[model samples]
Each structure stands twice: as structure tokens, then as C-alpha cells.
Target: MADGIDQLPVVRTITCSHPSHAGYEKDFSEFWTGAPDSKLTNRGDTKKWNGGFRGRPALADALWPELRNYLIGRKPSIFNNAITALRAFWRFLDGYERYGMEPISQLSDISTSLSILWLNPIDEMWSAHSRQAHEIIGVLVRNARKREKMQSAWAWHPYPRAESTESKELPTEGQIRTAMHLLKQSAYGIYARWKRADAMAAEGKNLLTVSRSRQGERNQKGQLKRAFDFELTEADAHATYRAFIASSGNPLPSMADLFVALGLNGKDYPPWWPTYSQDHPQAGQVVR
Candidate 1:
């Protein structure tokens, strides 16, 4: 079975007596008997390959489409036993009768000349059906050889040479959502501030406005038309009175000067103001 590996015929029958099929049989034998047995079971030959070449487990009948979709859609065309084993195994089994049916007289003998081309897979026939099967087998062979090399190379080297792979902490879903929300909110705030500044510059810089009249008389009534009259309002009297008391010795502005500056008169002034003292000893002249 091992010699003339390329010319080895398709599996005609799987039986315990033939030690020929050992590639995947060992691992699969455990499935049928639960415990590993000495050799292949009598039932092993009769058992349907069911996609498992040696002893692989059967795929659930319902998931065939999902499995097919997944395998076909996968990138890089994964060429592993899980992908190609079942189909090739079944093909070999079904084609068994047709392959052996040919007359023995018609069989070619390589007694005289050797075809080293067969020993080395010729590129011309690389895409051939039989050769494609070998190609898949070659992938497994190359993988096994690579693993063997890695194992042998590492045998004498340090055991802990492989760098430890540390797991990283990734942000949570909530954190991602929060970050997006904050970015959008910050963008809106910046835009609002820019628009507000533009609007403020367009109209004289003001965040609030009071009613105004275009052609009103310049009297106490005109106070209503002033753009900013907070200093002339009723609150202004109280604030000014407090300031005057606070600055009593600092030389107060004369009553006439105050009336002119504040758009007021001694006539319109409250009764308490007429008696107020203007005679500070230090006040040689009122500071208007």
C-alpha cells in the first residue's frame, strides 16, 4: 500500500484484514466502538463512509446547506480534510467498481522503463482529476512535513521561546456609543458658539434686547427707546443711592449735575432727596 503510492487503486473495500488504509482510520475507530480497539472492526467495512473517510463523524443531515455556504464563502479556499475529505472519499468509494472493471490484459506494466514524471507530479497533469485529488492530499502532506520540521527544530531549543500572547481590554459597546454621542454634541456646541458670535457681531454685541422707538421725543419717555436703559431704570436709583452713600466723602456730583447726567430734575426727584445734605466740609467744589 505504501509503495507505488501514486498508482495505488481507489479503495475497493474497507476491511480489518487490509492494513492498507491507516491514514485516518486510527482516529475514527474510536467513534464506532466508544473505546479504541486493537484493529479495525468487522462492521467498519460495512459502515457507510458517511463523509468520514476513515472514521470521521457524519454531518447532521439538515445543516448541509449552511455548511456548504460557509465553506464556499470562506476566503483563501481552505483545503483541509473538513472541506474536501468527504467528497473525495465518497468519489473513491463510488468509482471503485468502474476503476477495477477494466481487463487485466489492458493494464500497462512499468517493468521496462520508469516514469519518474509520475513520482514527481508533472505540471501538465497537475490539474487532472486524479492529480487534483493528489493536490489536496499534497496539502495535508506538506502540512505534516512542516509540523515535523517545526517539532524537530524545537526539540533541542528552549521550551519557553514562544512569546506569551497577552489579551487586551477593548472598550465596551456603551463606551463606544458614549464617545460618538459626545463627538456629535461637541460639534453642535462649537457650531452654536460660532453662529452666536457671528450674530452678536452683526447686531451690536448683545445677548438680550429691549423695546426701542425710532422718532420718540427726547424726554423721560425717551428712556423707553434707549437700547440699554438698565442704568436709567428704577433699580438705577437704588444702586446709585448706595454708591453715593459709599462715596460720601469722595466729593459727590452736584444735584444739578446729577439731574443732567441721569435725565432727571429736582422737580421729579423723590421728596427724601430735597433735604439731603450737600455741605461736606471737604467739598470746596462738587466733582461733576
Candidate 2:
């Protein structure tokens, strides 16, 4: 039974055959007729008396709270009745419709649901848990239809991924060689020279070889002074390079030449060259 209830068909009617207000009026008449105070009159029985008793307000106070509870809780029954009333009211205003009446609940959600359910051929009420539930369902239906139309317009075809133009325009082998040659002449090469000099200096030697004499010169006091000769071993060169690297804040060397300005090594120096070839294939090789 619970499964059946879960699978129950939706009722999407705008209204029933009769208006609830009309039903209330009919019942009210019957109640009035049964009243003990009910009295009849002749054509001129009293000057103030009319043919019928004065009509009471259509709805009672108790009915209002029941209606309020239904709308607040979105109890399915209130949702349906409110929608029904709205549809009837609209139809009544249209004048062309024979059956139309105002609805009980003035809630916005209830009115929205009525607009949708009123579209159904069966013209039945749709129950919802909350006033907004009606609006939510309408939105879902509208979005679903929009998605369907979008799918059909392209014949349900899938779009292919776009290829990157940059990849297709890759540089040729000649361009690569030209880039390498230009890089060799860049500041990176200068840094490499400084790194080699620094490494050598760490080992208590200089990477640059001074061909000047080791002979001493006489001092002011007639004492002989040792020559200012400079040369660096491989380990010293490596240490010198480390120091140069530290002065750089570990940043990649800029394109401009900072090496020559620091006097690491130069074209004037040969054989005692600043760099260790092969180990440093690039202009500058960073040691880990």
C-alpha cells in the first residue's frame, strides 16, 4: 500500500466541477432553514422584514486558521485547494468561462502551482508539501523542456575538442640552434664563469692564472715582498662558484652580464679557464 501510494499518479486539475464557495453557500442555506428562529412573512407582514434572512459572511473564523495551517505546512490538501480556487477565480474573471471562483488560500506558491496544473487536460488539483513546492516543480519542468530543445537543435551531436594553435606552430630545428647560440652569448654564460672562479677561490686558489713573476720586490724598509701570483685548483674553483651563487640570492641569473663586471674570468685568461666543460653543457649549470 505504501509503495502504491508512493507511485500514485499525479492529479493536475485546475478545479473540480463545483466551486468550494458555492458548496459552502448551499450548506449554509440548509443550516439556516433548520434554525428555530426561522420565520416566514406575508407580502406586507412587516415594514422592515425582507423575503430572506440576512446572509452571514461566506467564511467562518475557524476556517481561516485551518487554511493558514494548510498553507504554512504546505500540507498537500491546502496546496491543491488553493490552486483550484485561483484557477476558478481567473476563469470567473475571464467572464467567458461558466465556472470560475476565488480560491481560499492567497499564498503565492499555491497560485503558481495552479497555473501549471491548470494546463493539464484532466483539470485536477496537484498536492504539494509547501507553497514553494509548486514553483519549484514549474521551474523543473521549464528547465527540462529547455534542455530537451537544446539537445534536439544540434541533433544530439557531440562537439570535438579544439586543438592548440601554439602546439602546431612549434619552432623548427634551425630556430632551436639559433636560440642555443644566442643563449651561449647571454648573461647565463657570465654567471657560469663567476661560479667557476668562486669554486676555485674556496680552495685557496684563483681560477685565473697570472703569468707575472713570483720574484719579490723591495719594500720601503728594504725587506723583500712576496709576488702577488694567483691560480686556483678544481676544488677551489668549485668553492668560488658556490660563493658567487650565494651573492645572487639563489635567483636565476639575469640576461645582462654580471660576471664580467665582477671580474670572475675573461678572454685574457686561457688554460686556467673558469668552467669545467662537459659537466656544464649549458651556459650555466646549477650544482645541487
Candidate 3:
């Protein structure tokens, strides 16, 4: 991300066409069957009008007639993004339909003066719906004007450019479940570390002098290292830190002094021991 990482495993949802081939579909059946098909079918002879548009009754009656022109020569990828934006724009307008629908009618008639809808999207990248819908409307009106031997309307850009969009749909249930499972595993790992600290404190009497018999340990990067010759326990160092508080009477404490008090040889410490010890805070002078 240019800003920062929002979530891992970049995932998205895609929208597909659904058939409403019963009501207004009949009125536009010929249009769908007529020509160079949409990018959805790779513009093949096979005809369809992307999930049939149930154009509002008597409103924007010319939209269905000019839809084929909108789909003509559109790239499939661009078409998908356009359709997705349209769907999002459509849902977004329901709340303000009184201010919206008229733009469709004006698509085929400049004389049909009406205000265009203001689409305020949450994510700026999703603002493409305005341009996409406007361009499609321009195609419809310009062609309709041509048929009547009238001057075509200028295809003016209505909104600023935004990043390409796929769809505005949220993540699916499967994606949520996968994230939850990974998070649970991470939580367990943290719990295990805390348990290890507790166990070391409880069994401080049986501390290990050398850990040569134990398995090799892994570092933060998961790299395996040679088995340690000495094991450091958290309890003693934690105790040392509480008592290691330096004062005017007591000089500052070094980790070297911490090691001697704990009765452990520094040479026997593993590569990871320095980091581990700092976290546990070993002390040599603080002991006897």
C-alpha cells in the first residue's frame, strides 16, 4: 500500500451478470440479439446485455435501444470494472433517487434539462462510476441524435479520474474465516511463550547448567541454532531487575554483572541467549 499495509492476503470480490430476462427484457430482446456483442462474451455473435437492465418504466426509454453501442468495442476487463461501478452507483442512489434518475432520460435528450447525481464515494478509487455512467449516456444520446439528423451532444467528462476498480463488494465469508484461523494460531503462540515463562519461574530450583541434551532452538527469524550449553531462566533475572534499580549510592548495572550473579558462564550461552537474557535480565552481583 502507498499509505500503509491495511490487511494481508490482498483479496477482492467479483460481480457477475444475473438474468432478469422476463419483464423489460422482451422490449430489448432484438437489441441484445442484434449485433457485435458485449466484451463479456468477447464481442462474439452470441448476444446478451449484461444482466438485462430493467430500465425504469417510460423513463430513459432510449437507454435500452442504445445499450449495444455502449458495450461495443469495450474491453472485457474495463467492462467488468464499469459494470461494478455502475452497480455500486446504482445502490448508492436509492437513498437519493429523487435527485438521480433524471440523468438517464437526459442521456438521449439535451432538452430534458435535469441535474446530474452527485456520487460521493467512500474510497476515492471508486469514483469512476460517474465518468463511466456519463460516457455510456453520451454514447446513447449522440447516436440517438445521429438517427434524427440532429447535432450530437458533446461527451464531456463529469468527474476527476480515479484508480481502476474491480468491484465494491466486501470480502466473502471464506476470507473472514481464513483470517480468523490465522489470528487464532498467532494468539496460541503468544500464550505458549507466557506459559514457558511461568514454568521456568515455578521450577527455578532445578535450573539447567548446560542445555546440550536439549533440541536446537530457533531464533525470531526461525533459523535453527546449535543447542545451548546453558539455559537462562526468567525468574532470577526478573528478580535481579526489581532489585537492580540503580541509585546515587549504587552504580549503574551491566548485563555482565547480571550473568556472574546468576552463576552462569557467558561462554556457555547460545547465540540467542544475549537477546533472551536481556528480556529476562540476568544478574551476577545482585546474588551472593
Candidate 4:
């Protein structure tokens, strides 16, 4: 029986009369041939694949567990594609019954079971991918029922949203200061490196001859030089500060002079009021 099964020709095509069903047929054929332990043999071959199960019953029994095992440490995109292929297989089975073949059990049962497996406590990190897969499967099942002219038992159930694991607390003032200091230091270092490079270039020497750490400091310096070809003006800083104040919903105390210069009454005025003055100091004056 095993040898006979191994000699069975691989499924190369899935036929359906519906024009819209062509893509699903192709996907199913590809999956059937490619899936591990699929008992169907390749053309002119008699060996069974090592990884996939034999037929629909074997697939139905082992698909989810095998899929979960395949997805271990895989990327989210790969997981999405795997689920898509599985859903296509289910769609093929549902459509095949239109030609007088026996109907398989509703795939929703398998989807629900897989969803529970995805939510297993030991592998909590895959919750997002699992939710996405569940939603995709739900959509596929709904579409398959509509195409087959059958009533759908697959009820819509919301997948639980994954909570963010990142820290939500705002940075402390000290932390902010430290970040600013680091930024200044980085800027200074980049500037010094560029100056050295410029001097080397002026002396008819290759800029690459300058000392650069393995962290791609040379590439970084080149990028920085190209980026800051033009100097940032005082107006830029003023605009940035104003934008920050607006976004932060904080009153701009230091910018009161800027408001007076712009002719807006700075005293007891709402933060958004525009001020203009003929002698108004450049927007950079207050910022400086």
C-alpha cells in the first residue's frame, strides 16, 4: 500500500469551471506538490517527500501542527505566505466538491483549532502573526462559502489585540539632557572628521586615507557632509521650536519676546496668537 501510494502521480492541476477560481486552483497545486510528506509522486518518480503528509486526511490531521513547527523563528512575511497557501488548499477542497466529490468538513474548525494553538502560552510572541493568520483564514472561508453557494458556519470572532511591550513612560529630564549631549558630541565628531577629510582632499590626497573606525564612520561622515551642504538658519530653529511648543501644548515663555517682535501681545495671550513688529528680532534671536 505504501509503495503504491508513493507511485501515485502528483496533482498538477485543479480544474474548476468558475473563472474567478483559477488562482486558487493554481495555488493548491503548487502547495500539494511542494508540501512535505505529500504522498503524490513527482512525474516519473516513485519516492515520497519526507516532510508532508500523504493525502487530505493526513493533511487535515497534521497541517496546523506542522505549520506551527515550520514557522518556528521564521519571519512574519513567511508566516503570512504559509497561511495563505494553507487557505488556498482549503478553498480548493471546498470548490472540488462542486464537481460531485465528497465535501470535506468545514475548514473553520481547523482554523479555530489553529488559532488556539497560536495562542499557546509557551509561544506568546507569535500572537500578532497568529491573529493576522486567523483573520486571513476567516476571509478565505467566507469567500469559499459564497462561491460554493453554501451557508457558512464560520462566525466572525475578533482576534485579541496584542499589547505593546515597549516602555510607555516619558523620558526624564536628565535622560533628555543626556540624549541632547550625545547628539552634540556626535555632531562635533562628524564635523571634525569632515574637516580632516576636506583638508586631505585640498592637499591632493584621498579622503579615504583618514582614520575611520569599523563602525562605517567614513561613510557616515560622507553622508553628513552631503546632507548639510547648506547651513541651518535661525528661522529654521524658530520654526522647529514653535512646532515643538504647538505639539507639546506648552506655553512658550522664552518666545514672549518673539511674540512682541511679531506685534502679538505676549501678555496673557493664548499661545497660538501671532505677533509681528517692524523691529521684530529675527526668529532666531529668542531661540538663541
Candidate 5:
């Protein structure tokens, strides 16, 4: 009887029959096997890899920690691969009715694991890999819970990195005056060029509309001339404005702000001005 039992074929049981189960099985199998031939040595190591989760409890208790350990000090590519595999496994488990709802303890466990990874020490000069790891963990954990729950958990924190120091020396009166003068000149130049461009755009639109409406012999010959005029004027206006902006070397306000600075009334502005003013109530208002 023992010999007969040993000879019997092994059977596998699948509790969930959802179509996604097949995809889950495939992802889990690939994660278990790992990519040994890949250039990354850590990725090729199968011993450290956790054969995918058997259930929700296993996923939270075993697989999460395994992934956190595997990703430590690893290259971004390998870290991303592990994260992707874990996401697929989690998604599959979440879809399956039997293990869909995650318990609070499991969520807490995963959050703690992420916090530990995030707080891991690194060199004084922060590395790109460390930043990437922090971002990935934050995104994954945030997505795992609802917005309200995430706010309540309060486990997540800003990335662990050095803050830049503020300059201690203040500008002298002469330096401040010189800077202000340069900024004013640049702003005035930009405003003038913007107004020219705005006028040209309005004229071009009118010319184009007129050219399009002329369908009779009385206006046929002048239609092409009008269209060419519109295009040339529009092109020149845009080019001049762009060149002025590029050369200004200073931050400038929006066209509407420039219009107001030039003392133009909002009521006499283009048709789009009303809509824009409604959307951005502060646009035409004077800024102090």
C-alpha cells in the first residue's frame, strides 16, 4: 500500500477559477525562477528569491519582508523588477474572492516593512538609487490603501535626505538696486513685444476670416494675397515675441498681466479675455 501511494501521480488544487488566476500563476512561477542569465548578479540569485505567495497571510508575513531585504543596496533595475513581480502577485490575490480583503494587521506589517526600508542609512551624498527606492515604496504603499486610510496611518514621511543650506550673506543696497533696474528693463521689453504680437494675431485672424469668406470672382485674386499677409504677419509676431522672451533672462508674468501693467483696460481686450478672467480672477488684477 505504501509503494502504491508513492507511485500515485501528484495533484494540484486551485481554489479560484477566475481567468486572472492563470496570469497570477505565470507571474508567480517567473518570480520563483528569477532571471539568472541577466547581467545583474543579485537578480540571478534564486536562493534569495521567495517562491510566490500561497495565500494572503503568506504574502504579508513572508513575501513582503523577502522583497524588502532583496531590494536593499540593489541596483534600480533589479529593485524595480522585484517590485513589479510583487505588484502582480498582490493584484492577483486582491482579485481572488477568497483573499480579496486585506486585514489591518497585514496592512500594518507591510507599512512597517516599507518604513524600515525607507529609513535605511545611506552615504551623506544622496544616491539616485536611494531616492528611487524611496519613491517606489511610497507609491506602492499609498496605492495599497484608500486616501482616507493613508492619511490616518501616518506611517509615510518625506524622503530621508540632506536639506540644502540657506545663504547667510545679504545683498548690499547697490546690488539690490542694480538687480531691480535690470528686472524692470527686461519686464518692459517683454511687455512691448507681447503687445505687438497680440495686435498682429488679431489682424491675422481677421485677414484669414475675410480670405476664407471670399468665394466670388470679385475677391478671388486678393484672397491668396490676404492669406499670405496673415501668415507672414503671424509668423513675424510670434518669432519676435519668442526671441524677446528668450533674451530677457528673467521671469515674466502672463500676457494678461503684461496687458494690465501696460495700463490696458480688460473690457477692451480680446474675446478670450472675459473667459480667461473668469477662470483666473487674479490674472488681470494688479499684483503688489
Candidate 6:
């Protein structure tokens, strides 16, 4: 008869969680999207908003808690570094999904059987966090019954720990030449803009306005036919009256007639100026 044998029973040794690993919260999936704005502040455990660890709420829930618990009370530095490293691993998993392979539902799903996948392509390390990625997975999934007995899960370690390449990487001649050409062009553009601004500032023209005074701006008398912007405040009105009294006579009847002979270009002014000037022409008329 063909086998009537049932699958063998399994027993686990490590608890994968310890009493000492008790400081941080289990669910940090909220840190993925609406980060600091999501009512949770970064207090030694969670990080602030970042593009890392985004768009996978379910995977984040499954993995982040165990990772956080792995080094919660022990080493804050490694925990922070692992945040970045783990995100790279998550992106790797995304690639794993795109290939139409069986998706990993949990941390333990990454068995040692898949070790060859990490080694075959030399450039695969570009998407991973190097050796630290192994350490991150090992620490997160290894939950011993007791704190002292805890060890990294062997399933993840042997893979990303591949040896370094034989030779050093260097830029090619073409790459160097193109880089130099681009830098030179950028410098020339910056110098041209700086010289233009310097020339504009030299002429009594407002450097920000970037316009020079033209021949059309000058009247027949050769005077600059520009509008004089004078705003009268309480202090200014008082100062004008004081200047008039001290000199024995103000040249203008009121502040109103000051701009009357020199007409406004349909601009707004205090209504009282025109009112005072219109009401009494000879009231305060004086010598030039």
C-alpha cells in the first residue's frame, strides 16, 4: 500500500519573546503612513515620518512588533538602524511578490531552503541592507523560552553574509569626462547670472526690480518723472507741521496741496488731503 503515514509532530525550543524585551509597544504599523501626525510621538521606540516602511500595513504589523521587541530595552542604536535596514528587506519582499512566487505570510516563512536566491545574483545586494539585514531578521524571529537561551534564527543569517566581490569598483573614463563637462556648464551658468545681477545693482536701479531707468521716464525738464511714494503717519504730519513752524512758513497750504500741483497717477490717498486743499485755497497760501 502507498504510505498511510501522517506528518510528524513538531516541538519548539525558543519562546521568541522575553520578559526583558518588554519596554516598547507591539504594534507600530501606524508609523508606516500617517507617522507623527497619527497621535503617536517618537519616544525612544517609534520614529517620526519617513518614506521608509510605507504602504504595507499588514506586513508591517506582522514584522515590526517582533523587530521592535527584539532589541527594545537593550540597544536603542541598533533598533533605530534596523528600522532603515528592515525597510529595504520589505522592498525585497515586494520584488519577491512581483515574481509570482509564494508570498511570505510571516517571519518564519523565510526558511533556509531559499539561501541560494541571495547568492546567485551578485548585484542583488543593491536592494538589500547588506549583512545587517540578516541580523535584523535573525534577532526579530528568535524568541527563546528564556532570555539567556535566545539566539538569532539561523534561517536568515547564512544568506546575505555572502563574501565581498574580488575587485574594487571604479568609475570609467567616459563617466569622469561627462561629470567634468556637466560641472563646468553649471559653473558657467552660475557666473553669468551673478554678473548680470552685479550690473543691475550698479545703476541706481533697485536690484530686485531688475529694470533700468529709460529715456521715456525723464520729463522735458530732464527731471525723473517717477512717482514719489510718501506715506503720512501721525508722526510724519506732526514733523511736517513742526518743520513749517520752525521755518516761519510752510511752502504748501496743507499736506493736500503738496501733491495737487504734482498730480497723482490715479492712486489712493487720505480723503482729508484733497478735502482740506479744496475747502480753503487762500487760507494758508504762502511765498515760494
| Native-structure RMSD, model 1 | 38.6
- Those runs of model 3 whose alpha carbons end farther than 4 Å from true positions after fitting are 1-60, 73-75, 85-93, 99-116, 119-134, 145-157, 161-288
Which ten residues in a row are the worst by lDDT in model 5? Answer: 1-10
Task: Rank all candidate structures by their lDDT, best first, as comma-separated numbers.
Answer: 6, 4, 3, 5, 2, 1
Top model number, TM-score: 6
- Looking at model 6, report the run of 10 residues with the lowest lDDT sum: 1-10
- lDDT tens readout by residue for model 5, 1-288: 001112223222112224434323112232222222223345664454322323344234334444454444555555446555454433333222232223323553453223332243122111123455454655555445442243221234446567676988888999987876775465445444444444443343222113232233333323222322223334333333233332332223255543343233323332222111223344453221
Per-residue CA lDDT of model 3 for 181-224, tens digit only, reads 66545534433443444344444422223334335666665434
Compare candidates 5 and 6 on lDDT and give the better one: 6
lDDT of each: 0.30, 0.33, 0.38, 0.39, 0.36, 0.39
Candidate 3 residue pairs in clash (backbone atoms < 3 Å): 257-284, 258-283, 258-284, 260-284, 261-284
TM-score of 2: 0.19
Clashing pairs in 6: 15-143, 15-144, 15-145, 16-143, 16-144
Superposition TM-score, candidate 1 onto the true structure: 0.16
Model 1 global lDDT (CA atoms, 0 to 1): 0.30
lDDT of 2 by residue, 1-288 (tens): 001111223222222223443222112221111112224456645443111221111222222333333345343454555644433332322221212434432222122223322322122222223334333333332343343342111011111234668555778999987875664354234434544543444454322233434346655644324333543344544443334433443223332223343342322322333344355554333322
- In model 1, which runs have C-alpha deviations exceeding 4 angstroms? 1-52, 56-82, 85-130, 150-288
True-structure Cα RMSD, model 4: 25.5
The better candidate by TM-score, 2 or 6, is: 6
Clashes of each: 0, 23, 5, 11, 0, 5
Error of 6 at 223 (Å): 99
Off by over 4 Å in 6: 1-27, 30-65, 115-126, 144-154, 157-288
